[model samples]
Target chain A: MYTSIAGSVARPSEVRLQSPRPSIPPSTAQPEPVGSAFADLTVCRHSVTMSDPRAAIVPAPAAARATDVAIELLAEMGQDFAGSRSIGETLRRALHRIVDHLDAAGGALFLLEDDGRTLLCTASVGATNIEGIRVPVDRGIVGRSVRSGRGELVGDVRTDPEFFQAVDERTGFVTRSILSAPMSVRDERLGAIELVNKRGEDPHFTPEDLRILEAMAASAALAIVNARLAAALVEQERVRRELELAAEIQRSLLPTPPRAGFPVVGINVPADVVSGDFYDFFELADGRILFNLGDVAGKGMNAALLMAKTASLFRCLGKTVHRPGALLARIDAEIAETATRGMFVTMVAGILNPATGEICFANAGHEPPLLHRDNGTFQAFPADHPPLGIAEGSADTPLPEATVHLDGGTFYVVSDGVTEGLTVGGAPLGVEGLQDILREAGRLPPAERLTAVTSVLTAGPRPLHDDATVLAVVGGSAVTRPRSGSAAGRREPASEELVRVSVPSCADRLRLLRQVVALSATQSGCCQEAADELVLAVDEACQNIIRHAYHGDPTGQIELSVHHQGRDLIVLLRDYAPPVDVSRIKPRDLGDLRPGGLGTHLIRALTNRAEFLPTPPGGGTLLKLVKRIR
Target chain B: MNTGMTHRVERRQTGMVVVALEGDVDLQSSPEARRVLLDAVAHGGAVVVDLSKVGYIDSSGIASLVEALQKARQGGSRLVLAAVSDAAMRVLQLARLDRVFVIHPSLEAAITGDR
Candidate 1:
C-alpha cells in the first residue's frame, strides 16, 4: 500500500503544511454558482440509521464490510499522524487511506488559509494532481461544506447544478459523484476533505460513507490546528529576537558619553523598545563643540528609522556645513524629500566655542533651548522657523541663527518629551519644572547634571509616555556668585558690544531683559553684587517704560542694547512710546510710599547717570543708564 | 516661571505670615511678591517678609514691601522684614525705607519679636 501511495502522487519526503504553493501554476478554474441552500442538499437519500434497533438487527453484509473499512482507516490515520510531525505528509497519507477504503477514483484535502477567504488544496491523490490549487471559500462543493459546517454529497455531478466542472476542464479528470465533509473541531471550521467518483458498480457515494468521512475529518482538524499553533509560536520568537538585535544596533549608533566634566553632554530615555528622540554632540578640529537634539513626530519603527537618517545626516553634513543655520537648512531639505507624510522633526543644532563662551545655533520649531545664567534666571531662545520636513526646500534667505555669548552660563537643548513628561504629581514637568531642575543641577558636572535633571521624569514611578532627551553645553567663563561683593573671580566681556535685543514692552518679558543686564555687568568684570545692582537698575528702567510710556499697553515694543566701554557698562533702552521730558521724569519724594514712584528712584540710585538720550528716528525715547564697574 | 523656587508664603505658629522670597525679585516677580505680601497684610496680623534666599531685589520689590507696610499701618498690623540680604538692604536704604520699617537680622529673631 505504501509503494502504491508513492506511485500515485509525488509527495515530498517532508510536507510543510503552510508552505507557499510556488510550484503550482495558476489554474484556469471557474467558480460554480452555488444556491444559498446548497448546504441543505445531500446525496444521502434513503439513508439507513444504525441507531435504529431494526436496522442493526437486519444489517446487510455490505454494512458490516463498510464498518471494517472504517476501523482500518481510523487506525491507519492514528499511526500516520502520531509517527510523523509533517502535517502535509500526514494529511496526504490519510487522504490516500480514505480513497483506498472507500474505493474512490480520486481524493483531495482542502484547508482554509489563515485569512479564511480561500480553500487551498494541501494534499491530493490519484488521477489528477490538483495539489496546491486554491479555490475561493465561496466556490465549489468543498467551499460549501466548510462554510456551512456540514458534509456535501452529490449523487450525479452531470445533473447537479452545484457541481464545479472547472477542475475537470483543467485536469481532464471525469467525475461521476462527489462526497465532501467539513473538517472541524467544535465551532472552528478548519477545512474540508472531498472524494470524487467512487470506483464501484454502484458508482455513487452513500450516506454511510459521508458519516464515516465526517468522523475522520474531525480527527484530522484537531491535528492540523495543533501543528499550526506550534509553527506560529516559533515565528513569533524569531521576530522578538530580531527586534532585540535591532535595538542593540540602534544603541550602538548613538555617540558614547563624554568625560565627566565635558562641557557638552546628552541623555536619552526611551518609552518603548526603541526611541524616536535623539541627541548628539561632537568636537570639531577648531576646538568648538557641535551639538543637536531632535524628536521625530511619531513613535515606533518608522520614527526610529527617520531618527537614524536625520542623526547620521547631521553628523556627516555638520562637519562641512559649520554654520548651524545653513546645516539645518540642508538637513531640512534632505528630510523633506523622503520623509513620511505627516511626519516632521523638531530639532535644534548649535556650535559652541568653549574658550570664547560663544554659542551659535538655529532652532527648528523645537522647544525653546534654555540658557541658564549663573544668576539663577533663565533665557529661552524660541524657534524662529518651522520644524524640519515641514519647510520643503532650502530657503533662498539664510535660515535665522541665534548667537549668544554664554558667559558663565549653561545652554540646554531638550526634546518636548522632557517638558511634557509626567512628574511625581502626575502633572507635566513644564518649562518651569525644567528651570527648577536646572537651577540645582547646573552646579553638577555636565554628564551628571543631565542625568540628575532627566531622572525627575525617567526615575519616577509613572511611566514615560514619550522619549525624553536633553543636551547641555556649559560655558567656559567663570563669574562670581551674586552678592559676593568683590570682583575676585569675574571675566571681562570678550568685545565691547555686550548684547542688543528687542522685545515686546510687556511685564512678562522684563525677566529675560534683566538677566541680560545682570550677565552683561558680570561679564564686564563687576562683582555679583554690582551685577545685581545693574539688573535692578535695568528692571526699574524697563518697568518705567512699560507703565508710564507705554501706559501698560502690552503691544508696544522695546529695544534694549548693552555696551561695555571704559569702566562702565551702558544700557540703552529704546521704546516705541512717545518721548518723555527728561526733567519731568524725576523720582517722586521717597516719603510718598507709592508703587508708581519707586521704579524711578531705584533707577537713579543704582546707576551713576540715568538720562534720556537723543530720540531715535522712530519717534521713541532712548534712555541710557551708565553704572561704572566698582 | 514661578517654580516655587522664587517665593513661597507660609503661616508661622507665632501668628506671623512669613513670605519667603528667593532668586531675583525684580519688576517681573514683584507683583507676585506684592500679592503674597498684601494677602498676608490683609489678614490684619503680624507679617514678616523673609529675604534670606533673595539674591537681588529692585525698587519694585521695595515698593511691594512699602505698599504692604502702608497697608499694614492702615490696618494697625505689625509688618517687618527678616534676613534682608545686603543687596536688598541697599535698595531699601537707598529708598530710606530701612529707617521707616522694622527690620530683623534673622527669621527666628523676627518670629520672636527680637528686632
Candidate 2:
C-alpha cells in the first residue's frame, strides 16, 4: 500500500501491490476520527474546485480536515492560472498541480479540436517516459469514457475487457487498477483523465481516486473551452482582413464624377463592399457610346459580385457590336443563364451619339424616370417589362421610346430608395417631391445641380433605411454660356493703353491673344459682354496686327490696352514704324501660313475705324484700332 | 445701378477699366467682380473698375477672381485687373494675386504701359 500511492513504483510493479503491506503499523499513529463532513475534499476558490484525495474514504471526521487542506492548495493554483497569459502553458501547469497536490498516479488533459472530431491530449502530468502519445477516440480506455460519457474503473487490468494493453508496451510499464473519468461540458465530450494505479492499496483503485479524476477533468475542460474560443476569434480576424482587401479592390473600379463635357452628367454610390447598383459608360465605334444603369436585387458582397458580372457582360457585348435594344435582350438571356438563378436586375441599356444628341434606351423594369426639358417642364417615363432574369423574351413588350429632345436640359433616373428616402421625420420625398427639388434646382448650373443632389441625400444623416442612387444626364446644348462673365463686344483702348507680352510663334500668338482677350473680358471693368460688336472688332484688329503687321514670328511682344469713354471701351494700337500703305495691302497667302493682307481686311471687316501714323521721333508706326463695349 | 464697391480690373485691349466703389463690399458682394468682369467684357468699352475705395476684400475676393476666370474661359474672352488698393493689395499679395494679375504700379501706369 505504501509504494503504490507514490505512482513511480506502482507503474512498474503493478502486480506487486497485491501483497498487503502494513506500512507504519496503525497503532503508532493515533487512529484519527472520521471526517465531520463527508463532502469531497476537492475545494473551490472563487468557484474554482480541486481534486480530493480522500473522496473514496468517506469517514466524516477525517474528511473535513483533509478537505480543508485540499481547498487551500486549490486556492493557490487558482491564483497561478489567473496571472498566466499563455492558455496552453497555464493548462499544463494546472494539470501538473492536480497530480502533485492530489494523490493521483497520473493525469491527462484533452481539448476539443476545431473540427470537433478529435480530442487532443495537450498537457499531461505523472507521464515520465511517454509524453507525445495521443489516444484516438477509437483507441483505448480514454476513448470509451468519452464515447459512453461515463467513468470506468478497472480494478484489475488483466481481467477487464475494456483495457487496451498496447500503451503498457509503449511505456515499458504494466498498468493496473485504473481509475478514469470523462470530461463533459454542455453535452460536448472533451476527453478523459486516467490515474494508472493507487499508491497505498490492496492493489485496486478506490472511489476516492475516481472522484479526484472527475474533478481534474472538469478543470481541464473549462480551460480547453477557453482556448478553443480564442482560436475561433483569431480565425474570424483573418476572414475580416480578406474582406477589407476585397473591398479596396472593388472601390478602385468605380469612376469619378467627370467634368460634364458637352452633353452628359451622372452620379453613382455603392451601398457596400460591392454595390447591387451600378452605372457604366464606355465608348463604342464611330462616336457611339455604350452605357447602362442597373440595380441588382440584393445586398452586400454578393450583390457587388453580381453588379461586377453585369458590368463586365455589357462591356463584352459592347466590344463585339453596338446595338441598344438587341443587346439588352441578349443580356436578359445571359442573366438567366449565369448569376444567382433566382435574383434579377432592373436595367436600362443605351447607345449615345453626342454629335447627333441621340440615345436609344431599352428600359427593362426599372424605376420610372424623369426627363427635364429646356422649357422648364418635366416628363416621367415608366417601365414596360418585369425586371431582367425573371422573365424571358420580356423585353419584347416594347416600351415606346419616349423621345424627348435634349437641349441643355437634364434627365434624372433613380432607384426606389432615392424617392422613397425620408427625412429623420416621416416625410418621404417621393417622385413629385423629388421632381420639385430637381425643378427648383433645374435653373442652377450643372455643377450646382449635382451638389444639390448630395445635399438632399445628406439630409438623412443616419440609419438610412435603404441605399439611394441618383443618375442625372444633361444632353445637347451642353454649351453653357459664361454666367460669371460676358465677352460681348469688348474693344481696344481708345487712349491706347497696351501691355507687351512675349509671343513664341504665330500659333502661340493666336493662343496668347485669346488668353489676353479672355483676361480683358473678365478683368476689364465696365460690365461683362458690355459691347458685342466693338469687342469682336477689336479682336479682329488685333489678329490683323499680329498677322499682317508682325508676320506672326511669335518672337516679339504684343501690347494690350483698355481705354474708355464714360463706360465705353475703345482700343488703339501703336508700333515703332510708318503708317500702313492702304492700297498695296493684299489678303493672306495661305500657301505657307503667312499673314498681313488677310488680317488687315479682317481688321477692316471687324473694327469701326483703322488708321496708322509714324511713331514720335522713331522708325516705328503708331496704329489706332477702336471698338466700344458699353 | 448700385455699382457698389468698384474694382478697376485691367484689360488686354486697353490698360485698365476703372470700376468705382462706394459701399461696404464684403463676401456678399465679392462675386460681383465676376459679374462685373463678365458684364464689362460684353459692355466695358476698354476700362478698369476701380477698387481703391473698397474697404474690405477678403478670401471671397480670391473666390470672385476664380469665378471670373471660369466665366471668361466659357465665353472666350479676356479678363484682367488694373490697380489694387493698398489694404486690398496687402490682402491680395498674401493671397498671391500680385503674382496673378497685371498689378501695375498705378492705374494710370497700367493704362500707360498698355499704350
Q: Write the per-residue lDDT of candidate 2 for residues A217-287, one digit (tens) a residue.
A: 66555545656676788788887777677666555444455543434455555445445777766665565
Q: Would candidate 2 be rated incorrect, acceptable, medium or high by CAPRI criteria?
A: incorrect
First chain TM-score in every candidate?
Answer: 0.62, 0.51
Q: Quote the lDDT for A366 in model 2.
A: 88
Model 2 misplaced stretches (Cα beyond 4 Å):
A1-222, A260-262, A392-402, A443-451, A454-462, A479-630, B1-115
lDDT of each: 0.77, 0.55
Q: Tell me the tens digit of each residue's lDDT in model 2 across B1-115.
A: 3423554443454533555543434333545765775666565244444555655444444456545554654566544555666656654553334665556666566566645
Q: Distance from true position, residue A22, model 1, in Å?
A: 38
DockQ of each: 0.38, 0.02
Candidate 1 residue-wise lDDT, A465-554, digit = tens: 999989888863221112123343222233377799999988778778877887888878999877887788788888888988999898
The number of the candidate with the highest TM-score is 1
